[model samples]
Target: MKNVVSYLFLLFILGACSSTKEKTGTSQAEAIEQQTIRKIDVHAHYRYARPYLSSFFQDWIMQAVLVDVAKEDSTGINRSWKQYVDMDIENPGVFYLCSSLVGVGIDDPDFATKNIERLKNEIATGAKMVKVWKNFGMVTKDGSGQFIQIDDARLQPVWDFLKENGIPVMAHIGEPVQAWRPLDNPMNPHYEYYKNNPQYHAFAHPEIPSYETIIAARDRWIAANPDLPILCAHMGSMSHNVDMVAERLDKYPNMMVEPAARFGDLASQNSDKVKAFFVKYQDRIMFGTDFGNYDPAVDWTAEQLDAEQKDLDATYNDLWRYLSTTDSLVIRKQHTRGLGLPREVLEKVYFQNASNFLGLE
Candidate 1:
């Protein structure tokens, strides 16, 4: 009787476990049917100096599941190139890298050949795109001390190589338009940033190309490379004016824009207008956070890093909330309602567009 009772008890336990597994499986299937996971941040900055760890930013990588890491040119920052490559290698499905190359040798007679070979190596080793920074028109100067704009003829070959090889270019061509305005200007979203980083303050420099000039050069390059895909990062630096961005989107079919570090600009706009812009150009937009572990200017402590990480996550959630619901919310001291984007539009802006742009689909 004791043996029989023990056997019955084991059977009952097994039956209960089986029943729970069946219920869980059914619930999972129902959840999958209701919503599919589709999210990608196409313009993240994961590259850092040698002593790199993902202590704070790891949740983003895991939650977003797919992040495109843009390896910005270290030029004066002393970033570790190997760190980016290693991260991509170690986190195969999680990270896609867009490597950067400086313009130190645009005037070099062998600039085209040397850089083309180097670009080929980067591509061969899993680079999906190449990044070009604002140094061309902002700070870099020719032998005559004249700023070499993006349309400089000497850099044609580099563009041609990227075009011929079908590699995309990620262009961070200019500072925000507010960077050119007076620091005291209240409307300038970047007022605080420029005030803190005077080196990047266009008002302080005075000699750098005007905001219009920088934008013109960038547009000229877009026209020149009609076949190559270009990602105009930070909403092509026209986040303050969605109409201007819309005009460019209508003009350049080969170009796409990513909203990285420009959420404040979007949130400040009329929510209805912002929703319309996203709806109209859902296919041309990609989501990006510009989140990274290092900023050479700041001597970051672990505590600071933790705080930044939490803030970044919170801001990202706010962005999602803005798109996913119609609730009114305050962002950056402004009262604005949510865009209430549809699920299809959200899928494209969040994931599909990135997959198509990055060739990851």
Candidate 2:
């Protein structure tokens, strides 16, 4: 009887030891997943046929030039995103999808009412945020043929709905400062684009609107609707000058800037100053690639798709290195070094700030 009792006691001890080991292993896995979750790209353009998507996407298109799929089909985009998410669900942080709204009939009297209902439906369907593009200030016009500034009173209902629902608006209000500069200027990152798409060049059409005018309209909107959250894309459209962007950040408490496709703009500045700017306002900036997937106008072969995936991997790594290291890199033809930000600051820029701002976490 004594021998039997001793053996049972030994078994109990061994069982406890095994359970502790398993718990430790699970915790280590969770920590590693958290690191991946720390990085989030707040801005990118993705097209899908579906109007509604869930709050979290498996693959968040770190960057795509363009993606063209059917207007009614969400399968392609959903599958791509799911594959990305499946990579490491335990980590629980990768990308949050923000869906866009089509401006099919802004001139109609029912536009706002219909869109408001649509926006509510989208939010119910899992959209985390809303995006309003440059068309508002650049191409869209009022009934009188005057360009519709972002602050146009006609859109008050939409703004009110967003404000009431606490849905942040990711607004790209105007073209980059380069759009107003001479097309021949080599310093302009958009030189090639403007050269090929001259219709968007502000230099060619003096009657359209001035940079200051557009900016003024955007600022006025922010001021008028102080409670509404705004995510200003492309460094608030002043990437050419960080000081100006900083000034606006200081002025607008409800605004945050996402640096997308403007790495060159920051790279051209003094690295120390730029790094300091990031560190100071870490909570107010987001890392975005502005990667888009547009329809290439032809059926993409498997090889073409593979090449694009390769390009995406390289681009994502490039931005990561720039933000998290001090190594020098040639970004957009400019030789610049990385910011080597601390882990805390990286946490904020990569994901924490976004989560807090969007109320996802």
Top-lDDT structure, candidate number: 1
What is the per-residue lDDT of model 2 for residues 1-361, given as tens digits with 9 covering 90 to 100?
9988999999999897677435333244333433454556777554432111222233432211111111212332122332222322322333355545434356889989988996787577455777776766776666678887888777888889889998888878788888887887776677777888887798888877999999999999988888999889888889888899899889999999988888888888888999999998998998777774555426667676656665764576677667776777867777888888887887788777777878875
lDDT of 1 at 6: 95
Residue 17, model 1, lDDT? 64
Per-candidate clash tally:
0, 13
Q: What lDDT score is found at residue 114 in candidate 1?
A: 90
Question: What's model 1's lDDT at 229?
Answer: 95
After superposition, the stretches of candidate 1 with alpha carbons farther than 4 Å from their true spots are: 1-35, 48-80, 185-187, 295-309
Cand. 1 Cα-lDDT: 0.74
Q: Estimate each model's TM-score.
A: 0.80, 0.76
| C-alpha RMSD of each candidate structure in angstroms | 8.2, 11.2
